[model samples]
Target: MARPVTNAAFEALLKAAGYGNAHAAFARQLNHAGRGHGTWRYDAASVYWWLRGRRPAEHVQATMTDVIGRKLGRPVAAAELGFTIAQVPATISYPTSAGHAFGAAEQLWAMLAKQLTPASSETFQSDVALQAALAWRYDLPDETVSRSRRQPVTAGDIQSLYALADHFTNLDRRHGGGSPRARALMADFLVRQLAPMLHGTYTDAVGRELMRAAATLSGQFAFMSYDAGDHRIAQHHLTIALRLAKAADDRLYGAHLLANLATQAVYLGHAQEATRLAEAAIDGAGRVPAGVRARLYTTAASAYGRLGEGRACQSALAKAERALDRATPDAGPRWVNYFSPAHFAGTALKCLSDLHLYRRALRHAPDAITLAGQNARTRALHTALIATTHARAGDIDTACGWGRELARHVADVHSARVNHRVRELTAALTPHQAMPQVNELLLALAATPPPE
Candidate 1:
């Protein structure tokens, strides 16, 4: 019997078109939503409809066309897809390109604009897709030009590329990691120098590691942009990152990438798929170092928590904690440094909090708060946790007090997670909004806007 036309068959077609391998390409295509949302349980048939001009929720048009074009052996145009699909009313407002690639790219760019408020459930899937696309771009060997007439490798290029990554990395750390300007520059750099760098002259192992590092960094940029709500761009970047990581043959990064993808799926309510992705990551990265392996387990635990699998959640958390005990600070990658005691406390507490074990959540809050150090983002998160838990526990006064504290902290900075937490707590404290302290704090927060 003829083989069924599966995602695998579709992917094979993509490779024939000079794209990266299937998962890498699909991962790249999903990159339109940022890596986290890449494995989103897509409306496969609905995507076929998108080619007929119906706009589906954020990033669907781009993702569908990008993938469909590869699969169908034709130019799959978003304009030809579901632009009129009533179910996808969310992403219809923004413009699209005249055709597939351009329209997709335009949609990607529009998604990256931090200023654009999402229409509905779309969130920032576009940025992720865009970022994924770029991250995997270096894996496309034919795309890298090696003209004999090209100028000698310039010191300026190297300095610029590394500096750009470092600059955005720093800003994202302090400002909460999303930056379109950085995403654009990084995308351009990947298309330009990075692809060529992989092609130029490294040994097999060196090339693999070099591409691996680039992939990891690209995914970071993708995540930052995704956090900023540019789902289209962020997704694209992560897709690209995964593609490159696969090409680099770093099993750990690929699995790690899937862990993030699983987390996104859970957050977006795709519990079944999230569990699968998380499981894939943990199993795939089994050969990774103990420390890296721990991080993977932690990611899986969180996904399990989201799905209300309490036993699975606790088990994963235990593994994560054990990994933490075995870890040597100097052994892990610099990127994983943020996965420290404070981060552990925060994520583990969140798992507890999500499961509605409010007391357990509360117990960890103090640890999180204490270990959170001077990072304002960390502080704001812990404070929000305290405020919300208190509110949930009917401790009105304490909730209001913590709400007031968060109000002051968020006055000078903008973080969606922070903003979301503050909003949640603020809503929880609303019954006591008339209380003098709560009223005063709200007024104070409203009086000042940070310098843009």
Candidate 2:
């Protein structure tokens, strides 16, 4: 009889145990586990679809479980490895203890690192969001106590982790999240490097800083996942990221995570939830720092615009602008350094564009492009937005001109949202689809693949 392979759960467990993309390693483990029985003959590629949520027979599940259990130095259950078709509990709520929060963060990291199919946005219960928000508002997690571990974590290790996160963020901004290699590279680092440190021994101070860094990177991962068109996966990461931020007592970063969650909510078409998250972000952030306050207000404006709440959107945008006026050097968390005058202008442009105030939005387009320095992806997105705004204004020539320019840079970054904007530009220009310029732009978009 042929050796049966179990399901995607097995693959996830294998990856979590560091067997991902290492066929030889997995083969060796499989051979060792099945040695007492008939030899199991298979190459790594044969199990590829197993990672895509397929399940194998019972014998296969048992064999794989043995291999994984032996490697993990404990007995493993088929259900634990994802062999069973049980519903995985959502870990979206805030935790009452630091340990619980960190554990949730670790599980979220594993799911992301393994690239598991995420729960659907429909599964995002509002009560979960409300519970998380209320918990964050009314209570803080207990302080992290010293943990017993094989290795003692140092401050230098924490700094290195922060530097690693910075490197990924820079790449994402310059190249785009759809880059062929960026997300996987970051995931590998999260699993192989940062995850270990989270389990290592650390002083309370070091642990706090480490959690903050982890939270920032997790949020970045969520955004990258979002840009790649994995909305549910992005939400899962953001929920866990917020928990980590809260556990660290990093109020500024927590607010930033909330804004990120709001942005995701807007993208998922949950306008009410988006507005709620954005408002909660602002209210929970007591004595907000200058840059972070602007970001939060800007996100609120975005949510409001999505809901066609022009008055509310403008009010939030005005507050964001006022917050910007009070900006000082590096006033917020280091992660929010990109929140600048240009960012404000770009966000305002989005709000106005959503509200059909194209002429007003167009006024800020030039500043957005000029000041979006070193961020090729942002430039591409803003350029596409400018093109769309022109299309909406009935200026086909200018729209197509910008669209043509955008086409040249489309292949440079890996962002689904950027591609979506270009597609929206195409739709906005549909009335003139018969035009040569319109046909040309359409062809350009056709050649662009969906983000991975």
Candidate 3:
């Protein structure tokens, strides 16, 4: 075999961080940073391997960057340590101008719809998401989104975009984000109809409204991509949505996008980055509406739970509950409509489940199920959560019963996220396969088809 390439940059950074070839010292810092999550147990040997170009997992790399940055009293990006991130397409980069951003978004939609390249197998990178959040938080607001073109846009045209956004949102809620009809319809509308409208002439006020509408549509596409397991595509679309929100000068909406990114991070197991993004949204959102505040805090609680910080997790959950109590049903923006009591309970169940508070988690199940209303995806996920909690609590028969219910729900939905939860349930119950009901549930789950 050929020799592994050396990571000279990483070695140099280690010295700059005052480790000075003391690999064990650096490893100790990493272990400290990763304490609550699980065992890092890294030693000099691990650092030596990394320097010899055995790249660590994405989450470990993120932790390494954090440890080194703290040591050197500066921000250290993954790139600075000789880690190569997957190249982001040019169209996915931060926007330089209103027209440029719109054009880039159009091209991105085409790329996503056409599948010009194979989907990436790489996991989500926390650093990339964090950097995008920071950019949105600090970047100067656009002076004007006004543009002159052959076609002129009107207020009525902007309203139509909003209507289309609502239509797509409803379709996604009913059919799930992995629905082929929803994906195709959204792509077609964005490319053939919305793209030209974005390029059309409009006043500054109209332009901002248009950008806001675009942001909403882009966010919907992001969630759809996420549900279909196209994580890289989801991150790209989410970043674009954040930029559009910035261009519209809507700080609360920008915070909302950051919260979404945090949720994605937590789903992908990047607990540290999720916490940072959630806190950034909460801190930067100067006196947000109660619903928005509740969402951000709930996101933080989920991240904290993932990290096994039960105390911090419970504190955040309490804050979210208080904020929810203060929120009126129709008070916040259109996006905040999703942050109802049922939705809050669902997230709380997830946080509590992660911390192994299984009984507490199950107590929220009824509210989550009954109040989920018409959202098939939410109902399926919460069902899976309930089943998984039972399995983890050593109640195989009860777990199997819930598993059968999940199997029924899974059959009707086409979501990778729901499928993933089913897989987790399967893993938890596999050892109980001697039981007939558990075996039957496993067979059912095994036969479930991949989402289109």
Candidate 4:
């Protein structure tokens, strides 16, 4: 009864789609975004929260949607949500595993709509009702995976694998998450280099680490499929990522695997399942370091916010903050890297924003802006959020002025999310026709239709 969507049920849905996450082919889609590796890596934990439920500032939300849509095919609004409760199966995880989180796909889309520039009612993500947001992380491969490769994996193969992973990582990050060209390179590496390497002999530790890197990159490739709206293929990539996780024997990172699964669940509208996975991330995070733990809990709080459990959301938010506090500014894993105090504040402000705690959101806005000072994209994002809050509070002049500034600053950043947020702000200002500056801002937006 607690299960809003069954684990096996999603597997069946994925199976029916003619794609599974296990195939390495999905990684090939990353070329679609034409992004470099530097653009793909983010404050993964904060993005996790946004993926789960917290409503980030408008610009960030738009950028996220742009980035994801560039990878997935259809645009994903920041407001979209799909989470669960009682997520982890004691069968594979501990019996008492803390699973079960917040809302589902509806929340994700809603957050996205909130970030949109042209506000017609249809653009609102809140109107979207996600029914399959949560699903099982360990989706099965119906047919035989044909794991038998012709050659064996050797130490040299691992070096090559790391090099390939690093190469793509840099490429995707600089460009966007959906770098199909880079993804193809990885796919080739998988077929020729990795497949041969896996066959060669290596220690269990080496194999696990190698698989872990492969799994992570495969999931990154899944982003490309998702951008193309090829859920069939995207599902396949997610599956491969999970299997790689198991091969690696890193349960904590496996929890990260579940977190991604939870993201898909929310997109599918499986709130219950999404929540469950989020809770599992938190539970498994206990053994991780402070920064990593913060990442897990922050993601959990996002799920909690989606579930509409205000207290739970706040509690999780507090925990996330504490975890952030526990970490020295310099301490964090390179894989889930790029989180800082500023990043944490931006994330937490988003949680409050999702809860409609506008005052808190506004208060944190500047602090987030300050923290994001080093990041032009992020600073622009926070600036837009504060402007939106001002607009929401009926301060049109303040809103218009900030909106104009955002547009000006976005002049240099090539982020779709930034553009979307700036546009959405224009849409929101439409209601204030009487305000001259609002109209001016609108006219300016109308004149350009795209940032200079």
Candidate 5:
């Protein structure tokens, strides 16, 4: 038998929020708030879906919270409005201190390693993300915890963990995050090598450093999970990473984590949320190096472009350029090292491309291609963008040329995100398949090996 609709919670919430007819109120609020992305049909009938326990999109949930909170003259959380925190796994709870955060992360990693927890299908939970962002913005859990351990920890062990984190990050960047085998290997290392170190004692200073390293590793795990299309698991890991970063008092890295979440928002097509998250990232990023600021600005620019805010996007791009100009070779940390001249150009190209400014995008493409260096995955992305611009401009020959160039690296780069661009290039050429070059491009893409 089908489960009956549960309207009690929503009905009560609506009553508390002072809405007489929720059907009309929801439609009016959503329209006024500009929550719909041209496709959301927010009308009286749509409210029925919520009453039936059918969840809306992440942005709608956020907008609903905002709208109701305004009417109630207070901050309204999603939980009070009947939205469960789906991003949090059953294995862990919110942590309050560095030691607590580290312990929770270790427990979760062990569960994942042992397959004690089932994989979740929930993708994006805006409420959870919002809570995390707010926590990161407001709470800097700097509580001092004694690092006395069963066995004394050494600097060598900490160095080793850092090296492992760096290695995995580079591997993910080069080969993409879709490899189950790679994820398993990293998890095993975390369980066997890093977990014990966290439990063993050290001084307060060393404990903070250890937490920071673990945060980096955890953030990488989260990103890999995201790249592999495991959004729920990614959210769990990301939450853990943010807490650990706060515990360690690493503001710059905390900003990076927010930017990572913002990137996921953009990828998931939540332009408004992406913009908000990116803004939060910038706000929390205090006194960072110019390179780091540039990177954050790049994220904001991407979000603005997605929203079709040309002026805002251009302003952000300008800020990124100025920041890049101010950056010195030895200025930023290793995490921000990837934001090189090529990276700067690539980000600007993407912003332009997202805004449908192909003329500007094409002008910037060659420089990005030239400086993309040995990063085949990045090169493939830049090449595909060039192909897309030509295709959009009705220049079939030029488009096919760039497509052929992109296909050369498509098979070599094991990144699904990059492959998405390749797919876009192929789609752009679909109408011209009668041309020999276009047909060849399609065949090449079709024959490319699946991500391992």
Candidate 6:
């Protein structure tokens, strides 16, 4: 008998569907989806056999794909899972027209509303992301955003949307982007309110402002999705936001969105792609406000840090500092207000820490904490950074002290990024578990429930 070939593509798709080695769970999902078909009692062993080259019935394959598609917030085909059939592309392209762009945004919003779990198997696609960035950089701006259908959109409508965006921004800053209440409210706002307005008639000037406001809200949701650990959804929203920015002819904001994408890429371990996106943002954003320029530099610094390019990272950081020095309090868009001295210091700390320069990273800890203002999520993250720095520097006692402080705030913030940092701190301290303080910190973290 011939040796059976493993279904590698199917295996990869299963993992990407958030079922990492959870064969039993995948089986259960299939069973649940196939409730009307028969009394299917698939288990881990069954999944094992399937992955090893045994093909399931056609109905079973359909059920499996359907389950995976829902979890991924997009469609999946049998061929994409390695079945012998006509191949279907399971990819989303960047929208090239306003009608398509709005449709894409609406589709994403609907999917987000239906998602039950935050887990996703969607990995960052550098080619797709870079292509979008390049398009934003070189695409011709839309000359007019005017529409001649539905009710006329007014400047008052734009102002109202901006005000709503501001409200959501404050909520995200204070409670973290993973806050369930904030996410729910923002989703409703986008779907019920913003979608209709986007379809309404408007003049060229109002249409431009409308697109800018829509881009702002979409970008906010993108950041929230990233913070919530939904990388694929975040990328989708960001692509839409970048397209909207282009439609509005706001190159600076488009650059900002690219920088945001770079930040996400670095977080998801795509450091090379991140570096390229960050560079694209800087090169394309001509004569932006000082704060925006500073932000772009810091974003590049982060990507370089992740790549271990110390000289390039430092150069970017230096440029960021200089640009930040020239930033006036009211110089840039309202969004740029978040890029203050404290924010710059925090970015520097992360960059230095990524290079294993723990002592240098610790130098910025105080400023990060004191100047973090009322942003609970930022404070928690900075605390985790400080704790991890100390632990990596062999200062277990001090690291434990900071870990204890972090434990106190763990229940308050709802950010996956903050939780990730806590996990990093725990990993750094795990080696010294023999010590009482380290043991206590670990126990506390183990007991800490994820934010609701």
Best by TM-score: 6
RMSD of each: 12.7, 9.0, 17.7, 15.4, 16.9, 13.2
Q: Identify the runs in model 2 with alpha carbons over 4 angstroms from their true place.
A: 1-91, 114-125, 449-452
lDDT by residue (tens digit), candidate 3, 70-176:
98999998788895442336334556555556656765664444332344453786777888888888877899988775457889988888898888777777667
Task: Put the candidates in TM-score order, highest first.
Answer: 6, 2, 3, 5, 1, 4
Candidate 1 lDDT by residue in tens digits, 1-452: 43333244333444555553333444345444533432233222222222333233434445556665765678865555424323212331211111222223323333333223342243434334333423332233322222221123333444454566666666665656433455555444443344334323344555455555566666776666555554544445455556656656666676767677666666566666667777767766656666776778888877888888999999998998898888877686555666666667777877887798878877777677664334666677778878888788777777777777777776544455666676677677777778787777666655646424
Better of 1 and 4 by TM-score: 1
Q: Which regions of candidate 6 are displaced past 4 Å?
A: 1-90, 114-117
Give the TM-score (vs. native) of candidate 5: 0.76
lDDT by residue for model 5 (19-82), tens = 6466666666765685343323345544554565544444456677888788789987766667
Ranking by lDDT: 6, 3, 5, 2, 1, 4
Sequence-dependent TM-score of model 2: 0.78
Candidate 2 overall Cα lDDT vs. reference?
0.74
| TM-scores, each model vs. reference | 0.64, 0.78, 0.78, 0.59, 0.76, 0.79
lDDT of 6 by residue, 1-452 (tens): 54364888888888898886787788778867887864455666556656765455455677888999998999998777775431112475678976668767755654444332454564777888999998898888887889875346789988988999988888887778876567766765675567657766789999999999999999999888888787777788899999999999888889999999999999999999999999999999988889999999999999999999999999999999999999998888888888777777888999999999989888888877875556888889888888998999999999999999999887888898998999899899999999988898899988998777
Q: Give the TM-score of candidate 3.
A: 0.78
State in Å the error of residue 420, model 4: 5.1
Stretches of candidate 4 off by over 4 Å are 1-152, 163-167, 170-174, 178-196, 199-201, 223-235, 263-272, 329-332, 370-383, 408-424, 443-452
**Candidate 1, poorest ten consecutive residues by summed lDDT:** 92-101
Q: How many Å off is the CA of 435 in candidate 2? A: 2.3
The predicted structure with the larger lDDT, 3 or 6, is 6
